[model samples]
Every structure is written in structure tokens, then in C-alpha cells.
Target chain A: MLRKLFKFHGGVKPQTNKTESTTQPIAQVPLPDRLVIPLHQAVGGHPRPLVAPGDKVFKGQRIGGADGSLSSAVHASTSGIVHDVVPALMPHTSGLTTLSVIIEPDGEDRWGELDKVNYRRTPPDELRDFLRDAGVVGLGGAVFPSYAKLKPGKEGRLKTLVINGAECEPFITCDDLLMRERAADMLKGIVAMRHMLQAEEVLIGIEDNKPEAVAAVQAAIAASGQSGIEAVAIPTRYPAGGAKQLIRVLTGIEVPHGRRSTDFGVQCFNVGTAYSIYEALELGRPLISRVVTVAGNVDRPRNYEVLIGTPMDHVVRQSGARPDSDRYIMGGPMMGVRLPAFGVPVVKATNCILVGSPALFPPPPPEMPCIRCGECAKACPADLAPFEMYWFSRSKNFGKAQEYHLFDCIECGCCSFVCPSHIPLVDYFRFSKSEIWARERDKEASDAARDRFEFKNFRQEREKQEKAEKLAAKAAATREKVAAEGQAGTTSAAAETPDVAAKPAAPSAEDTKRALIAAAMEKARQQKAQVAPKNTEQLSTETQADIAAIEARRAAAATPPTPDA
Target chain B: MLTALLVMTAVALVLGALLGYASLKFKVEGDPLVEKIDAILPQTQCGQCGFPGCRPYATAIASGEADINQCPPGGEEGIRKLADLLGREFKSLSEEHGVEKPKSVAVIDENTCIGCTLCIQACPVDAIVGAAKQLHTVVAGECTGCELCVAPCPVDCIAMEPIVDTLDTWKWRYPVIQIKQAA
Candidate 1:
């Protein structure tokens, strides 16, 4: 029976370049001398380190524990001695470093204790916790923690569960190969997921181009004899594998901005995530390795089941890449980031390592100013007005850009792929998003400072008011005491003489001022007396005679003035 | 005409009574202008604005008693924000208060500290944490770098250190024009 499929708004068909890697079966690469695993493998908080340096770790021992609900734990790829936990370069477009744990493989490949739980007997919440501890996350580019998506929706039960096998990005075929080889394991994982979500049905959406994967999954479903679990081949497009896009293609439901698919009684997960879930519950294994497609500028391109934290340089060399390869990208050409260095680790999210040469991938042409072309808008999968957002982002008017729903853009590179003017539209959008986030962080800091400052001010004012009120009350009490004493004195005086009682209660202002002036004069007089003529007492006789002569002349002059008056 | 005039007076009286009652029922309080001004002022409460605190300074600015440039803790950016809020021309920060400097927090050298309470009394925000005649330490998070306690310390143990940016506080800088190098 044919099921009706739905189409998304806009997409561009880039050359797949997947045949080079898909011709051969998936191979395994030898372990390196060391592995550098970054604590932050998922999209949320960085996991805390569990095993410190110099500790013995097994091949599948939990090394990094999940920080919170939004984070996923990380396990050791192989048995080794913990080398050092330090800051090392990560596979990111920003070329930044984060906390990473280095391990020296002991070559023993020892396995730790494993406890496989029966899914039928385990509760849903406990199973989700088990998956989280097993380090299960979406391997379809986003790498979101899988346990977070297994919960029921607001309606108390999921209506449909869409398993994404749509390897739509060009030059990425790891998902296709995974489904073809391990379709039964993938099916078992889907059944567990369906049981956990209690969904009415399960729809595995695969792109039509991968006919082999589709057939294998169909066979797995038939062998299992599961009801309500069907395979639906979707149209091959650039981003049909996007969670929202795949959800739409499978269920014909359009998830709006700021709303989740669960709100509509649906949830989507990558097929690789389901396979990891199955491995965790069935084999009691943690996510230690994944199938990574190594292509581009390599003589022998193929997919390898590479261990997590294996350096990208070793993987590229094993794939027979030429020494002249100028750059390396971590994902497909459409949404991949240029790796800063090949020494960065192969994280859980790394699905492809595309070696780049000048001939294979040339530098883009000089960016030209936008000419108000509507090409980008038409190619935008989210149906956003890319041109308007571009104008605002260029001017740094993020407020206006947000009004045009800038956050809704998935940064799929479709707009940049179709722009006539060769404008790097996605770069501008990324820049805008980071800038907005930075500004929001700054606003929060300022607001906190303001609150603290305001509280300080309020506290000071209350203290001052309390102090003033206390002083006022004390002054009132003192005045009352003084008045009562004065009243008692008057009554006693009246007993002695009535006339003395008729006098005023306090001294007049004139008398007080006169007395104060007199006291000041007396103080001045006392101070003058205290200062005696020091050297005059020891003067010689000659000096005293000379002083007497000068005094006599002064007295004669004063006498003449007195006679004239 | 007389009857119509009496009827009009009666209606006016009833409406006036209703309006008076509504005014008393829904009385709006608080000065929104002061709140707006306070939001613009960096709330250092350093008393650099000649007022007791940021609230008083905001009130003074709103009432036209204080200039926007009187806040040194806010610096020139603060003046610009205040000017924009009040529709006044921006001016350089007033030197009477102090010169603008990078944000700093006070740190007391515990070994050199003599357990004197002078610094504690001088602190405006009471950011110092200690007891009388006991070793006092500055709460780095709460210290606004007012430098009021610096002069009061007899041992001169308090040091104003500039805040350092770490990875958590780091942000992506604005894009710079890149000139391609010769390959």
C-alpha cells in the first residue's frame, strides 16, 4: 500500500558525491596511541569528568557523567589509563578549545561490568535513565540527548513516532549504510522506543534514493511481524532529514515556530539514535564508536566504524587522503564546519570528515552586495524572508531581524546555496544569533547589578530612617524629663516664695548671649595669661637700657598728642 | 428654557460625583519618571553623584537638580544612556566626582590586616565581611569599587583589582575586515 507523502517549501539539489563511500562495506580502523574526548559532546551543558587523571578505565567505562537533564554522559572508547584532563581544541567552526579528557589505550580493550535490563519489566522513566547513562544521543547531526525525546507529549500519549533515516545532505551516507547493515537492530530499537512512547504507530521515513536501505528496513519489519510499524520512502531533498521536515513528510503535520512536535502528539528521532538505544538496552553497551564517512580528495573513500575521540588526522590518512588536502570539514558540504585542525577529536556528533583540496572545493567568489533578489527567500525551507533578515542583520539591527523571525532560520545553507549575488546569508544569520545571545547575557548581568544596587540603596535608607526615628524619640523623652524637673523646682519655690515662681521657665535669649560672650572673653584672657614673654626675662642690661630709651620716646610722643587733643 | 437648564445641572452633578468617586477608587501612585531615570543610571550607589544613593540621584536627575554626568561609576556610557532617556545633550563625565576606570573589586590582604573596623565603617555598600576587631574580607561580588574604604585602612591592605574575563565570560567579538594574505 502506498502512503501519501508531503513536500516541504524549498530546497536545492547539490551533487550527492555519496557513491565513492557507499561502494565498499563499512570498515574498522585501528586504535590510535591516544584518544582525546571532549566532555561536551551534546548540545547542552558540559558533562562533568568522572575519572580523573591516572585512573584505570575500561573500554566502555563511563568517563564523563551527565551534568543535568539536558546533557548526555560520555564513555571511554577503549580500556586505557587516564592521561590528562585539560583544555584541547574541539571540532567547531569557531576553532575554540574546551575541557577534554585524554586517555592512553592499554591495548587490553578490557570490558567493565555490564548489566542488561529487560525492557518489558523496566518502567519507562527508568529505561530513559538507562539510555542517558548509556550515552545515547541523536547521531543525525543535531546530537540531542535521545532520552529527552522519548517522553510522552502534552496529550499524555504520542500518536505517531517518526524515525528519521532520510540521509538528505549531499556527500553524507553514514545513516544509509547503518540502516542497510543493521536494519534488525534498528527495528528492535524502534520497537523499544514505540513501547516507551506508547505511540499509536511508527513510521520510518527514508529518502527514495537509498533503495537498499528501504528494502532492508522493510524486511526487518516483516521479519519482526510488528503491527503499526511501516517504512515510508520520502522524496530525497537537501534537508528532508531535518527533525521538523521529516516530521512533516511522514505525518503531514507542520510544526510551527516556538512550538514542538510533541505539542501535536508527535516526536522524531534519528535511526542511529534508535540503534544506539537498542545496543544500550540489549547489549548493555555505551556509545563508544560510530560509523563515520570519510570522503573528498581521498584516493580510496569509504565509511569506517571509528571510535569516538579518534583524531581526525588518523581517520583522514586511513581513508587514503592526499597530503595536498588544504582543509577539513566535519560534516557534509551543506551544513558542515571547517575544522580548525585535523588533531581535533572525532566527537559523537561527527558523522563525516570531508578532506578538502583547492581543486575539489575552491574558495567562494568575492561577496557582492545584495541586489534585493528574492532567490534566498524562495529557497528558505522555513519560509522566512531571508532578504529582509539579511538587511537588518547587515545593519546590526537585531531587533528588527528578530521581528522577521530570525531565530526560526535553521541555518541550512539553502539560502546561501541559491543566492544569485553569492551572499553568505547563513554566515550573517549565525553572526546575528551569536550577537543576540551575547547581548542577552550582558542584559542579564546589568539587570542583576541593578537589582543589587537598588537593594543596597533601599537598605541604607531604611537604616537611616530607623536611626533618625530613634534620635527623635530620645530627644522627646529628654524634653519631657527636663520639663518635669522644672515643674518640681517651681512648686518647691512656690512653697518658699510665690514671687520667685512667677519668673520665666528658661533664661532669655539676650541674657544667654551676654553670658556666652563674657565666657568667651574670659577664656581669651586666660589664654593670654598662659603665654608669658619668654626671652624678655633673660635680656642683658644694655639691651634693657636701649628698650627703656625707645619707650621714653614713645611716651613723649603720646604726651604731645594728648596735649594737642 | 428654565426646566431644561435645571435638568442639565442635575446631570452634570451626577456625572461629577461619579468622576470624583472613580478618581478615589483607582488612584495611581509612584513616579514613573524616577523609575525610568533609575533604570538608566548604573546602580553603583557610590555617592559620586553628590547624592546619598542611586535612588536619590535618580530622583534628583528626574527633578532637574542633578546633571547626568555626575555619575563616575556609570562613566561616559552611563551619561549617554541618561541623556538619551531624558532627551538631554550628552556631556563628558564630570571630573569632580572621579575619572572613569575599568570595573574593579576590593581585596583585603588578610595577613596585613590589623582587624581594624575603620574600613568597615567607611564602606558604603557594607561589602566587607567580618566582625569588630576581627579580620575583615571584602565580598568581591558585592564590592562596587567605590574606593571609599581604601583611605580608612591604616595598614593599606585593601587593593582594588580589575575584574578579569574568563572563558565563561568571553563573547564573540565583532567581525573585522580580513585582508587575504598571499598564498
Candidate 2:
């Protein structure tokens, strides 16, 4: 059936460049001598290493335990002996190192105990936990943990489930080939996901450009006899495969940033993620390998079922990488980051290892100033003024850039592709977005510091106040004791010497104290009056000023009463 | 005409009096300016500004008792923010107090610590943990690198280690492309 599709704003039509890899079927790569798997392969917290050096790990064994629900577990691709967990260079644009586990494959190909559950029989929460342990994550480049997004919305049931198989980016055909060949397996996973969401309707939206994948899904749905599940064809457009855009096309419901599609009675997942869900729930197998496409600057561009932590150079070599290939990109050219080097191991987010050569992907023409041609704004899929944000971002005016919603940009390279000035508009947006995040982190740290400092000051003040109050109470008790003793002494004196008692209490502590203070004050006052004037009379004006300053400081100190007083 | 003008003035005076009463009834006390200034100051509480803490220094700045350049930890960028907030000209950092350095946290040499509680007592944020005559350690995330603990440690055990860039902290640099040069 033909479904009415909604259009997302401002997408560019770049060459698909996907036919080169999709023509071939997915093949497996031989296990390398070693693997360096980073613990942080997803969006959330890094998983804790579950194995230590000198430990034997079985195939599909959990090597890194998920930190929480937001983090997915990590498994050893094949049976191996743990070599050491150390900081190794990661596949990020920053070229920084993170904690990774190194393993030397023993070639045993052994499986440890499996923890598989019936996806339908188990409760939803328990099933989600199982998937998390199985290391099922979105393989559509976002690498979000799939289990975290599996729940129903506030309505307690989903209205529609959208399975993403668009593969809209140029030169990335991993999902396309996966859907074309493994449609039945993906259908099983889709059914499990539908059960988890309890969705009323299921629609698998594949780009019309890939008629083969669409036909395969339709055939699988028909064979399964699931009338509720339908495959819909979406128009071929750049970024049409984005979760929000795909949801909009399938259901005509626009899901904004900071909002879940489930809230709008719909949720979406990548076809690869659904396939992993099937393998995890049905076959009792954990996710350890994925389909990665090696394209661009390679003699034989193809797709391979690459193991996690298999080095990129090793995979590119399998595809006959040309000598001119100077740079390696991690994902599709549109949104993929340039790998620091080819040596960084393929992570969960590696959908394509796009090798770049100067001949195939020339250095960008030197950037000319933006012409205000409005071409970038027209190509921006997020409906933002890319030129206006470009000005703010270039000027380091992050506040203004935020006002323009700079983060809404998905960095799909659509604007940069369409820009007449060749400004590398996407790079500016990335820089601005990172700067904003860094500033926010600094702000949080400073706020935390302020809270701690204020709390410490408050604590110290309270302690001082408590000590002062205790001293005051003690002094009051002593004053009462002295008063009682003085009264008795005054009576005894009065009784013994009538003349002295008639005048005043003599030889009492109170009387003596009062007399000493009064006499001391009188003497000091007289000496001050006598000596102050004499000293000032001979002193220079500068000395007099110094005296006045000292007097002011003394006055300031004298205002607060002493605890003893 | 005179009677009409007199009645108009009477009504205006009555409304003015009512507005004044309302303002007094609902007026907020205390200088919010001090709070605004305090929010701009980094709360390291190193006392390099000759004040007890950041709050006291903020209060002094708000009242014009202290200059805006005294905080070295805040650096020139912070001074710019302060100048923008207070509508003053940006001045160079006051050198007599200290110089701005990279963000760092203190690390304690446990071998040389001698179980002294000096660093623990010196930490303004209580980032240091351990009781008297025990092994003291600094919580890296909570530390502000104020360097107050360094001087107080008799064994000279505490050292400030500058934070290095990691995947989590790395940022994209501004683009520098030359189109004309390429031509």
C-alpha cells in the first residue's frame, strides 16, 4: 500500500556513490592476531573491563560489563587470551587515547555459557536488560544503546514502530546489503522489537533507491504472515534516513530534538540493530561483529562482516586498498570523522571505512568568504540559517550561535556540499558545538566549586558560632557563681565590721574587680589625654596620618564583642 | 478649565502614591549585583586576591573596594566577562597576586606524605580525603588546583598536575583556510 510521506526541510542531492559496495554480498574477515577494543563504543558511560591480563576469554564472552542501562555491554569477538587493558589511540577526530582491552586470539573459537532468553516470554524490563548484556546497539552511525530506547512512551503502549533501512548517506551500503540478504533474520528481530514496544503498527521504511532491499523486506513480511508489519518506500534524499526524518516520512509525525519519537506514539531503530536483537534473543549470541563497507580509493570496494577491534588497515587491505589512499574516514563521507590514523581499530560506530585519496577526494578548495547566497540555508535539513550561524561561530560568539540553534545541525555535510563559497560550514558548526559543550562543562565545574567553597565557609562559621555560644554559657555560669560568693562575703563583712558594711561590701571579688577596672580606665584615659596631644604636637603630618589609619583599623576590630565579654 | 486641571493633578498624585506604596511593599532587599559578580568569579577560593574567598572578593569588587584584575585563576577571559558585566574597561591581570596557569588538580606523593593531615586541612573544597596522621589523597574531579595545600604540606608532598587533553575533553580547533593563497 502507498503511504503518504511527509517531507523534511532542506536536504541536498549529492551523488549516492553506494552502488560500488552494495553489488557484493557481505563476507567475513579472518580474525587478526590481536584486537584492541575500546570500552566506550556507545554514547553513554564507558563499560568496566570484566577481564584482566592473563585471563582466558571465550568467544562471545562479556569482556566489558555495561556501566548502566544507558551503556551496552562489550563481548570478545572470538575466544582469546587477555593481553592487557591499556590506554590506546581511539577512532575519534581528536586523536586522543582511551581505555581499551587488548586480546590475543587463541583461535579456539569457543563459546562460554550463554544467557539467552525468549524475547516474548520474558517481561519487557528483563528483556531490555538481557539485550543490554548482549551488547545490542544502534549500528546506523549513532551507536545508541538499543535497549535504552526500547520502552513504550507515557501512553504505556506504542502506536507505531519505524524500522530504519534507508542508508541515505553516500558510499555507505552496510545496512543496504544487510537488509537485502538477511531480511528474514531482520524480520525476526523486528517482531521481537514490536512485542517489546507493543506497537500497534509496524512499518519498515527503506529508501526507494534500494528496491532490492524493499522487495526483500516485503517478501519476508509476507512469508511471516504478519499483516500488521508493512514495508514502505521513502524518497531518496540526503539525511532522509535520519531517525527524526524517517519517522516523519513513515508516520507524518514530526519528532523534535529533546523529545522521543515514542512520545508521539512512534519509535524507530536501525535494521542492523533489529537484526542484532534477533541474534541475541533467538540464537543466544552476543553482538561481536558487524557489516562494514570499504569504499573510496580501493580497487575492489565491498562489504565485510568485520569483527570489532579488527584494525581498519587490515580490512582495507582485504578490499585491495590503493597506495594513494592517504586518509581513512570512519563512517559515510557526509557525517563520518577522519580517523586519526588507519591503525585505530574499528569500533561499533564504524559503518564504513571510506578510504580517501587526493585524486578521489581532493583537498577542499580554499574557503572563500560566505557570499550570503542562501544556498547553505536551503540545503540545511534542520531548517536553520547556516550562513547566520556561520558568522556567529566564526566570530566566537557562541551565545548568539546557540540562539540560532547551532546544535540542531546533525553535521550531515549537506550545507557544506551545497555552499557556493566552499566555506566548510559543517566544520564551523562542529567547532561551535564542541566549544559550547566545553564551556558548559567548565561552568558546571565552577558551580560545583562555588557550592563546595560556600558549604565549607558555612560549616566553619557554624563551628565558630557554636564555640562562642558555649564559651558565653560557661562565662554566665561563672558570673552567677561569683555573684553568689560575693553576696556571702558582703554579709560576713557587714556582720564583722559594721562601719565598712554600712558603706559598701568590702574585700569582695565583685567590689575588687569593679575598682580595678575603674582605676585602670581612669589611669589610661588620663595618660592618653596627656601623651596623645604631646606626641602629636611634635609629629610630622605623615606620622599623624599613620596614627589615624591605625586608629581606624583598631576601631573596626573593636566593634565585634569578644566571646569572653 | 482650571477645575479640570486640578482634578487631573489630584488623580495623578493619588496613583503615584499608590505605586510608591506597592513598590515598598514588594521591593526585594539586598544587592543582587554582588551575586551577579560572584557568579562571574571562579570559586577556587585560593585567596590570591587578598580576600578570604571568592565571595568576599566579589563583594569587594561590587563595592569598588577591590580592582577587577586581582583574580589570577579567572584569567584575562574572566576579566573580560567581568568588565562586560560591570561596564568597565578590561584591564590586564594583576601580576602581584599570581599568574594564570592551566587547569590542574593537586596530586599527593604518598611515599613522602608522612601521614600528615596538612593538605586535608588546607583543601578549601574538601577534595582531599583522610584523617589526621593517615594517608591523604586528593579526589581529582573535585580538586580546583588552588595550590593552597602545596605550601601547607611540611613534607612537600603535594604537587599540582595540569590536566591533559583526552577524548572526553578534546575540542575542535577553529578552521584556518586560505582561499586566496591557494589561488
Q: Candidate 2 lDDT, tens digit per residue, B10-84?
A: 999999999999999998989999999999888887777767678889999999999999998999998999999
Residue A271, model 1: lDDT of: 87
RMSD of each: 15.9, 13.3
Give the per-residue lDDT digits (tens) of candidate 1, residues A69-147. Answer: 6889999999999999998988986677888999999988888987788998998888888888899999988988988
Tens-digit per-residue lDDT, A347-461, candidate 2: 8899999999999888788898898999988888889999999999999999999899897888889999988888988889989998999999888988998999878767766
Query: Best candidate per DockQ, number?
Result: 2
lDDT (Cα, tens digit) per residue for candidate 1, span B44-91: 655666675677789998888988899887888889888888899999
- List residue ranges in candidate 1 displaced over 4 A: A464-565, B1-34, B42-183
Residue A36 Cα positional deviation in candidate 2, in Å, after optimal superposition: 0.8
Give the fraction of reference interface contacts each candidate recovers. Answer: 0.09, 0.56
What residue pairs are clashing in model 1? none
Model 2 alpha-carbon drift over 4 Å, by segment: A477-565, B1-30
Deviation from native of the Cα of residue B89 in model 1, angstroms = 5.0
Q: What are the Cα lDDT values of the candidates?
A: 0.83, 0.86
| Estimated TM-score for each candidate | 0.77, 0.85
* Span of 10 residues, lowest total lDDT, candidate 2 chain A: A501-510
